[model samples]
Target: MADMSVAAPRSRGLSLPRVNIRAVVMVLYLGFLLLPIYWLINMSLKTNSEILGTFSLWPQNLTFDNYRTILTDPAWYMGYVNSLIYVVMNTVISLTVALPAAYAFSRYRFMGDKHLFFWLLTNRMAPPAVFALPFFQLYSSIGLFDTHIAVALAHCLFNVPLAVWILEGFMRGVPKEIDETAYIDGYSFGRFFVKIFMPLIASGIGVAAFFNFMFSWVELLLSRTLTSVNAKPIAATMTRTVSASGLDWGVLAAAGVLTIVPGALVIWFVRNYIAKGFALGRV
Candidate 1:
């Protein structure tokens, strides 16, 4: 061969690693999405003077007074407790009502079935502002105003419809043969639904519960309109940060951060169910 083969290329002293375009894009997208949340936390750590006096990325004068005030003050901590109470109530009530309604819609064909489904969705689409006055007056007249139940019931107007819609899609995906099989096996409707059918649609229930909780937790107009001192939600109580001394930026930011924690925890726990719900064409 007379040494005709070319020698391998000599090693370079330095070489830049190839950049992953997708990873870079993902990092940038995450940064963009998280910037506001990061800023809120940053503001929470700073004093009102530091927050207003500077626009630094990190707090120059870090303080925990805002968090301390929220944790120590009954007005603040009770707002969080009130919010949780109503949100849990609404989620339970919505799922309880929607499950049967969804099953009926999925398994049966009846007059006005489709029309009724659409009507339910229309209620979800309707503005809360439209019913604010009515709900306020109704709750007040019935002596239900400023109670946890009032906010829970008010939220059901929207959450129940949404829960029904979502659960109906999931229920429709289940085979009708399962119901027939259960019947043949002597399983009563209630027993079959509770023991067999409910498990099959558990992911749907999780998705519905997550949405219902989030809607009820974050809904301000209805919660605020329906409640005052006794059942004031965190969303309503957050507004109290504004007073004669001007806006309490630090406390407001701290409250917002705390408010996001519950919904974030719910999403974390049900993330798998949410993914499955979407995959099942029910989200």
Candidate 2:
């Protein structure tokens, strides 16, 4: 009787673990997070009249006129080019400066290294507003105002320290013995770093590059403040979409959507490195 009772419940037990509550919760959370993006995309394809005429979970009448306007206008299209230029420039400059600094901090002990590292990071903590006037004055004096380099240099004030901090953490995870062995093999400092050490920490570099790109891409205040006609970023141009005629909500949403594409691509490309960084305790 007891054997029969146990066997009777075995089928019921078999189905209990099949439902993954964790996966369900994650899916719900992802959907919640994605709802705003979906709404924005929905709005971008809709006419201003349609948007105001009804509440919608999706566009009733899909249109591409908003994208057409942005693509055709030189002023509008140049905003994206200018933004991309500065963002790429800033990421390059930040990574170039941070790598050696990070290596020094990670591999060597120097006077007040801790104090210096802390001070560098403190630069990132200060609000950009505090330096906006100073930066404007400096760039104006140097004839870099209204140029892509101006925005890139201004952003460096923040991106450099962040890059250094992240790189330093990743560098510390690499064993010092590798450096010694490379040296013993007659590899010079620069050669060893480029050919060996850099590849060893490739994941860290990917993560750092991803971060630098993301920060510079999204940062508006410095980019907008430093640039004008010659090198105006998309964020600044988006504001001009508003005129005496009122706002172009569809075009604005479309611009916002386009801005997200580059960052998303960067994230997707570096996803493996990000995961590896986490595994190595570098993130």
Candidate 3:
């Protein structure tokens, strides 16, 4: 006891070196990630003239015309709205279907269950190109092509499997005793799931939703192929900026910058859930 105070300072001093090294590593990694984002912002601010004329690190003039064009133009802004519609619809559909399927996988074990689970995940591993022609023909025959619902449903082919996998992991982390106790208390399965199981796995749902939104948001291949001009996505519109004449670098950069907003909004809303969802030791 007499020497405890004296030893405390020495122990703390030893930790300082490790802390400093961690801090340095974090700073370097953050800089590496932020550098490219900084470059995009810098390019977005610069005019077409400045972009082609000079290799300047910073623009001599900053203009809002790019952002302005995106906001003012119906074709541009509507692309964002169209993207949001499909992304939200896809996320909702995927999560709803995944929650029940994942519950089945986690709470019950049956014949060939593991094989079925792997098969679900295997859908995710399939190349989008392989499904492109079949998807187009399928959507066309059903008269669902060129509609937002078509793309939303198409995205579910991949997103549902992913959502199921993520939520199943989270559900597996919950103790079986909780379900047993709830059953013993005379709670119906529906009541128990809605009240107890759902709250426990809420974080996982948010995390899964974020992933669905991100994947569907940035995906070009399926979104572009499934829809014609009326339902075309922002990614499809970006192609129009380039032609035989030349690329409209300003509008294109502006469009690229604008595309990041929906993803950012999604992360901002679900960031808290993401951290908690990844935590260990629940089971």
Candidate 4:
């Protein structure tokens, strides 16, 4: 009985150290991830005087003027609208095109299908710089340049491929027998895809939408190149702060902070779908 008791305590003792180590690692990782965000929030609350005068961990005089400026300014708000329109358009175009392409890749076998998949992915691998000039001239010639559609369609060049790859993985994880059964039950391809496959992979769609939103949200080069003052995105506005005098650090920082809001709202709404999406796809 004494030996048995000692063995149980020893086993627990061995587990305790591992648990403690994992806890410590997790704390450290969380700190690493959150520290920059903390600093940004901290800086946003400080005055320009305080920001330039001293380096304090906390604000000397907390102010809401930064947020006030962003909220009250038409230019700032208009940029938000431009960004929203383009981002949504880009996501819609990407997913609509990708869904059918991904379905084809997952369900059908065709000549050079695997090679085509790789080639599609390679579009994403190309640097944005390489495509910027061609995109600018192409859009300009067609009179699509400087419109929200131009930016949205340009984003599709990269986003569509990523959406296809991600959704394909999710679709492939679905059992082939499900498709066979649906067809056997007199379900047409359209009905089976809409009524069956879509519901099963709704989480994947959410994940793909989230990714497309994020990439297009933060993208600067394509957005800046595609629009001038009339349709300039917030990212382009951020660059205008750099003048002969210097960078408007305070306003720039404030704009940077505000830019995070839409992405945050998106993630907040879709966070529930992330776990299920991963589990379904094993991705």
Candidate 5:
């Protein structure tokens, strides 16, 4: 009894707290991924001189002038508005066009169906550069140049195919019996699709919209090529930071930080849907 009590006290004193290896690794991995974003924000708040001269994790002389310039300047802020306009338009158009096309693809059987599906995918596979010149020329000739709709339409060339492909996958997973049953219960195709079918694949729609939004928002080549002034996107505006003096590093950093905000907010809003969409959709 005396020996047992002594050993228990000794063992208790020597014991160590449990360490979760996976949790530690995850934290370290996340920190590594976020380090650049943190540094960008850090640089945005510092002057160009400080950014170039110092190698600090945090800004020494913090200033909001960089952000203030972007927020206050019409040239800078309008870029954001223009980008939102086209990106939203593109997403809406892509989903609208893709829904019926995808449903047709998922539910029908016709000649060249496989070939047609492959053709749609080929458009997505083609490089954005391949169509850039053509789009530029076409839009310029049609008086659509430098317009938000021009960019939105150009983006649809890519986004619509991808949206169709993704939505088709989700639609395929859904049983045809549901469609039959809906028709049996005196429902029109439009009513059944709008009320019943669409809800079933809501996750897929969210995922498609998220991807379309991101692509349209970040597409520099087409947006820059097609637009000049009135409909210039923020991606195009960021290039103005380069001049005879050199790159405006602070303003550029601030712009980069601001650019990340919309995408991040979108991811936050549709995060759960994206997760489920991937799990259920063909992706």
Candidate 6:
């Protein structure tokens, strides 16, 4: 036997790193999460009769009539416009008010500052239903009912606090030396905040804006209570699809699908910033 010892089989270098169990698990979890959304899209393209009478993994009779009606009808399309208006307004207002508040919390040591911060977070903890009646009564009495601004303002009650909390985390990570340096350079407070500080925390602002927009967009109770005709959001509009003849499932599904578009777009645009913020633990 040539040396009576065959060379041991060459090692395969640690068995070629095993498949990542965590990655496989995450992919399965995501697929499970998205299955219902896939079903909704599938239903949107089918007739209401086809939807109710059969159960299929995919639409058998796909059609675009549901989407066509939504696009062509003023009542249907205007709901999207109304929703966008308030959502944008709410996002802007929340970020505007929260930026200053967060800066104060993060950079200063005022009396009762800790208590105040706790109080602000408490507002976010409260349920929207708790304030619905009061909001309705007040907005109605003030002639602000059924207006876009009414919903936007009402939403600020919640969004502002959350925005402040998120922004405070980001602002704290920034060095106070920068503020002093800007002041030394004779940069006005407003100019420094807008031009320098804001850009430094662009990721935080993006995260905050995305949160504000999404909450205001999908909110049903507050938006519904705040508006009826002129400012009725797409969510409220979807309710009209129900009638004596039963639900128009196709149209309703289409509307629901459309309602997700703006939010999806906002997320897509801000995704990179959001990831950065989260990575930094600032969101």
Candidate 3 C-alpha lDDT tens digits along 1-283: 1233357445666687699899999999999998877777788888889999998888789988888988898888888888889989999999988998999999999999999999988988988999888999999999989899999999998899889988987888788999999999999999998998999988788888888888899888998899987788888878864563287677787788788876777788877566544442132
Residues 169-225 of candidate 6: C-alpha lDDT, one tens digit per residue:
888878999999999999999999999999998878888888888778878999998
Q: Give the lDDT ranking, best first.
A: 5, 1, 6, 2, 4, 3
RMSD of each: 9.7, 7.7, 5.3, 6.3, 9.1, 8.8
- True lDDT of residue 180, candidate 6: 98
**lDDT (C-alpha, whole model) for all candidates:** 0.88, 0.86, 0.84, 0.85, 0.89, 0.86
**Preferred candidate (lDDT higher): 4 or 5:** 5
TM-score of candidate 4 to 2 decimals? 0.89
Candidate 1 similarity to native, TM-score:
0.89
Per-residue lDDT tens digits of candidate 4, residues 216-283?
99999999999996678988877774463286556667788889878888889888666644443444
- Candidate 5 — which residues are off by over 4 angstroms? 1-21, 276-280
Task: Give a tens-digit lDDT track for model 1, residues 235-281.
Answer: 88888655633899999999999999988888899876666554434
| Poorest lDDT segment (10 consecutive residues) of candidate 1 | 10-19
Worst 10 residues of 3 by lDDT: 274-283
lDDT of 1: 0.88
Can you give the TM-score per candidate against the true fold? 0.89, 0.90, 0.88, 0.89, 0.89, 0.89
Off by over 4 Å in 4: 1-14, 242-245, 272-282
Any idea what lDDT model 5 has?
0.89
Better of 1 and 5 by lDDT: 5
Cα lDDT of model 5 by residue, 1-283, tens digit: 1133246444534434524666788999999999999988999999999989988889999999999999999989999999999999999999999999999999998899999999998988889899899999999999999999999999998889889988998898789999999999999999999999999988788888898998898889989999999999998888865563398889998999999999999999887667555553654
